[model samples]
Target: IIATVGNGMVIYIFTCTKNLRTPSNLLVVNLAFSDFCLMFFMCPPMVWNCLHETWMFGPFACELYAMIGSLFGVTSIWTMVFIALDRYNVIVKGLSAKPMTTKLALFQIFCIYLHGLFWTLAPMLGWSRYVPEANMTACGTDYFTQTWHSRTYIMVYAFFAYFVPLLVIFYAYYFIVKAVASHEKSMRDQAKKMNVSSLRSGDQNSTSAEFKLAKVALMTISLWFMAWTPYLVINFSGIFQLLTID
Candidate 1:
């Protein structure tokens, strides 16, 4: 449904008009394109797997399908990290970093495909590699189920994918929050000295906005914990098990 709506909108916007294809929107379109790929590539197989719980399509079909799915999934995930970096750069550096040109965005889009290729195609043909066990030939996927690689990849993924992004967001919001707080406190101190009449309106508004940002950061941290922490914990346990085994 999300992909359907989102991609459909992109298609409609891009094809329907020429003017809306500005550089930044074009980047958005590229993102939507990947997201469309991500959703369609990942979901149908998941639905199929859920209903069947086994691959009826045979090994070749499974490999091809899972390869595409996992590739796009990783693409989507990494692209999101890219998007966060883009956003952070924009906020911190402002128009100096500027809008990515259409050509640049297309290059970025190409990079995403290559990035996906490393994870998905490389594993299949055995370059980057995912070694399949005998009898139960499966795609090198569901990192959670692969006890050994899962732990390593999971930790790396969490650190690079989650922690770094959170840190950026935290620092961004922290500065903004602190600036506002400092301004508000200054205003309050001035008000204490002077007439309290003029201080009530915009002062309160600025303070409110600062607190709202703080709240949002808190919520974001909470959601991150809920979303990825369990997988991290599971990986941590697996790592402990390996050390014990050693």
Candidate 2:
């Protein structure tokens, strides 16, 4: 589910090195934590299931694994979506995007993880319950795959977990790209206008550099798209099944 060893290293360095922190990179570190949380919570059972297709741990452990994995899984998406919004505000709205302030990014991080925990833990409280069931070959399924009442659980989980975050991600990036493109176009036009006036070589070089940097940022949006796309596709297929007749 996760990749990018190079960027991950950079995020790691930024997180541990206090001087390297910024709002944007701090968010990236938050993303790494979410991915690691998913790993710690998911990878052991997944490996066990693949090798033996049985739960070495009891039912309680299985439930705990599912709950923690799902929590961080959803939180990862929320982190990216919120980062997109922060980027938009910084670039387009001129708001300060630093991590430290009276108005801080930490509060937003708290909200994101808390929201994930609230939704994921709710099922254990009689809002929903895990049921014994099997995948095609007999591996037990997640709660959402277990029973009839699970439909409500799936709907609410997918809505809060995937759909809204996706909407926010697409919306924020759309504006961010637009704003960047607009600025680049304006710079090119201004450079053209200046070209007729016999400006110095240094100013023209600055315009070219600005245009190149804009292109890089535009290209990087594809990173976010790739990160979330596979998960979204799998999730949406599950959603589509409800409307299809067996």
Candidate 3:
């Protein structure tokens, strides 16, 4: 419910407020929209299934449910990757960085969705399969199968969806923090030379904005990882026979 309403409000405000429709903010809206889709479509049915003590939607519906969840899940991962990269560009490159434009933002968003669609559809295309989870109340990529085909998909998907993005986000934010710290030192040095308590205004707004966006990205990514990492670990353990899939 919180995810649904919070993300929905973000989407609504961004759509209605013209001033908030900047190119960089478009990425934020994309993130919100993806979360909105996942929470709106996936949660209600999942709760229903949980209450009913099984996935009453049948096999086909199970697959469809898992697909929708995976699709948006992948997209959200990449969206955060893009957000981190964008922050790196703005904060590290400063004025030399190319300004974000609506065209580029939309292009990137479309590509993110395409990448997500490809991965989610791979199971349907024989790379792997989606089946009811061990709990019987949810569906997900088949982790119980001992076959190499299914195990291989889980490995490759985890590499792309988890590790790759994790690395990218880490790299971007590391540089962003370094850049901000360097800028602060420079500002303090100049202020000392002029004998002012601090330098305020001008670059302050830009730095504040960068910090705000970075905070949002960090919080969202942190929570998302916390939510999903256990499931991912379970999949890996199952593939390796560390845990009985049944």
Best by TM-score: 3
> In candidate 1, residue 219 scores what lDDT?
68
Better-scoring candidate (lDDT), 1 or 3: 3
Question: Which residue pairs clash in candidate 1?
Answer: none
For model 2, what is the error of residue 109's alpha carbon versus the real structure, in angstroms, after optimal superposition? 0.8
Show model 1 residue runs off by greater than 4 Å: 14-19, 127-246
Residue-level lDDT of model 2, residues 178-232, one tens digit each, is 8768876776787798775443377557545534543454455457557656655
lDDT of 3: 0.90
Q: In candidate 3, which residue ranges exceed 4 Å CA deviation?
A: none
TM-score of 3: 0.95
TM-score ranking from best candidate downward: 3, 2, 1
- In order, candidate lDDTs are 0.57, 0.63, 0.90
Clashes of 3: 0
Give the residue spans of candidate 2 off by over 4 A. 1-11, 95-103, 131-148, 196-246
- 1-246: candidate 3 lDDT, tens digit per residue: 998999999999999999998998999999999999999999888889999998899999999999999999999999999999888888889899999999999999999999999999999999989999988898999988899889999999999999999999988988877877787798899999999988878758867778777767778788888998998999999889888733
Q: Relative to the unseen true structure, what is the C-alpha lDDT of residue 119 in candidate 3, on a scale of 0 to 100?
A: 91
Candidate 1 at residue 44, lDDT? 72
Candidate 1, residue 190: Cα displacement in angstroms equals 13
